[model samples]
Target: MNSLTAFARPVLRWGGDPSGGAPYVFADPSDPQTYTGFDYEFAEALADKMGMQAQFVPTDWESIVSSLKRKEFNVIINGFEPTGDRAREMLFSKPYYLFRLQLTVRKSDGTITSLEDCKKYGKSVGTLVNCAASRLLEEGKYRVKGYQDPVGAYEDLELGRVDAVLMDVAGEMFYARSNPKLKPAGKPFQTGAYVVGIRKADASLKADIDKAIDELINDGTIEKIFRKWNLWDDEQVKLRTATPPAIEITTTKLNWSEGLIKLFKAAMITVLLAFGAMFIAVILGIPLAVGQSNGGPLIRALCTTYIEFFRGTPVLVQLLFLYFGLPVIGITLPGWLTAIVGLGLNYAAYESQIYRTAFQAIPERQWQVAYSLGMRPILAFRRIIFPQAFRIALPPMTNDFVALFKDTSTAFAIAVWELATAYRELANATQSYLGIGIVVCCYYLAMSLPLAHYAHRLERKLQRKSTGILSSGAEK
Candidate 1:
């Protein structure tokens, strides 16, 4: 028996994003352990047709294709549209379900009645990053904001952050259609089809899946699954009679120059965010460290509490709360500012600990000597204690700054397109994950290696200066 034979593998593992939510694979509300959705049911049927049991593998929507490439699963059965870019990376089975683009806007908005209106008024439309809808908006030169999922895009629409959200009709059916505050701005447009993605090496499995899909369509099993989730429509009937559209292979070369330009811009954003947050961390952290080190018990306790709270929690959770949770109490900040504040505040806790340790490392005689020289407490701190502590803390602070550059990637959770996001988008577009990833690494190294080198030099220089001063003092 071949490896692709059902007897060889009793379980067919399919990857999808449960968080992509309904009409796609999502956790069943009644039983959170089990998943439900048209896609979920359809996958089960597909597996059964292949004489195997269906096993669902939860994956993030953004990296689902890459996960498939890594052989994380046997196939990807998510709401994957067969686009030219994706066609280059994986072999797709015949199209299973027809889909369309849906534009959702707030109920109170009268200005944007359609996609054209959004373009005419220059309103920002939110969409899943690197998806067909985003590509559509980009092609039209419309203001586009990319979200990781439809839920965030729709939430932003309701919160008035984005004027409208463009996504698949399947997502709209679950996320936007039921919300009273939101309405479809126009009829769904732009026809497409969802296809199962299989690795190129899995041609046998692809052939098996294609045959199963044809059988399922002919036997009406696919329609039955769709009807269970209220997803059945006239558009699906065409799947039986019509041959799945040929996967368009674009002959154009990957635009390395344009991709590099985008990466450079995004790298600059990463730099700006890292530096801005580091500035805030330094400004806030010094006082926090000082208060904790020198203040009375009550002040020390408060600082300790803040430091513990921020340090103990994950930075990604803090960012999500700052961007999504804050708006619940009527506080809303833009994505960029929120990213800065979130990263800065979280890093401040660590920075405080570093400074506190540095302060403790300074000998008590330094303060006494400054006092003996008739220096006030503030002057003594500035001229003696602080200068030495700063030297002691500089290396670690530089390390944190470098780490903060990487942490800036977490900003993508809140929709800020930093270098990592750019790289992912470029990989998605060009299907050159390794090459683009290497280029992105070089960009980060370009930004961080110089800073790291400078910090090392400065630390050595400071050590030499300190040794010279001690030598002079010993001679005196």
Candidate 2:
């Protein structure tokens, strides 16, 4: 049985902190229930018409592309554009909506008029990352400050971080209606039509979804949702009246040697980055952990704060900040360096905690014996405390390898040709998991599953060695 799902964040989300003001975007507080909007209504009707169980995939908006390509959702039934380049990647259903993108700016600053006119606004134009408007910003020579979500872009505009924000016509109006500071800076620019996306390889599913859209429109369900939202404009009505065309696709064969070679290449890149980062992490983490565990007040405090800060915040942010963020401070690391440095720092912070715990778990008598045997505190810790701590942390330290392996995927954001990037590119291009992605996942499992199995083996072996009766040579 086949199922279809709609992908969307809440239509109504908030922006900006109310008190101190640092931009926030959240699902509509007024309407707390899920699937309350016109999008949900359309999804329900489409499912009924197609006779497939309708599923709603609540996403962070960031995951839309990744989730769709991962086959986590079969159909992306939100405001997605059918662009020339994207058409090469994923199949699009007949547009259910014709959206005009609007440039949003502070009502006080009134200079912009059209998409082309946005050039006068200077570099700090803001838009959602991977959005249609982002392309416009680039083509129009506007430097975009890409935000994670729509509200974040608007918040940037409001806070003066950016001169303007660009979004779909509905989002512009919807956000503008609620927030008085923001207003359309120009004429509503027609960007193009928006359609639900289906992975191109899923031809049958794509056909069924297109058929369902026609069915729902014929039965008046689509119009019902549009009218309910006050969005049933006459222009959109005319567009929908036309017959939805079946999308045609052309397929190409894989370059057997070239692809396999690239696969090996990417795998090597991923492995090297993961292992190198983990190696740096272990080297840096141990000393920091020890210093924090036994150092003077200021040094201990610094180490504790470092551990807490890195552990509390997300590693992805740190990576993005390093890759994209550090340039603001006149320090630049090439993307490759950023990947290794960020991954190393994140795991180092985590590894420090692990070592700290291992040290604390050791018996005080072990330290005393070394000290009583004419060893200095430093020598006692080096000869006695460190070895036991290493033995104690051996299992958890090995478990860290799995996470370190997964962290390599984050390099994709910076355009590093790691396995995940290849998987995404191939999945988008072929629209089939059996193509490049199946091979890539095999690579992931090839790399990770063994390390995981080894970590498990190491853990068990260490457990056995620890529990074994102390022999004359056991002290080593």
**Clash totals in order:** 0, 2
By TM-score, the best candidate is 1
> TM-scores for all candidates?
0.90, 0.52
**Deviation from truth (RMSD, Å), model 1:** 3.8
**On residues 1-476, what C-alpha lDDT tens digit does candidate 1 reach at each position?**
36566456589999998885676989999999899888888898899888888899998877888888888899989888777777776798998988888999999998998999988888999998767787777667688888888889988888888899998888898889999999998898887788899998999999999999999999989888877767778878778876555433222235888778988999999999999999999889988987898889999999999999999999999999999999999999888889999999999999999999988777677787899999999999998888888888998999999999999999988888799988876676667889999999999999999999999999998887682223222211
- Candidates in order: C-alpha RMSD to true structure: 3.8, 10.1
Kindly provide the TM-score of model 1 when superposed on the true structure, using C-alpha atoms.
0.90
Q: After superposition, how far is residue 8 of candidate 1 from its true place, in Å?
A: 9.7
For candidate 2, list the clashing residue pairs, or say none: 16-23, 16-24
Runs of candidate 1 with Cα error greater than 4 angstroms are 1-9, 242-253, 467-476
Residue-level lDDT tens digits of model 2 in 435-464: 776788788889988888887787777676
Evaluated with lDDT, which candidate comes out highest?
1
Query: What C-alpha lDDT values do all the predictions have?
Result: 0.86, 0.68
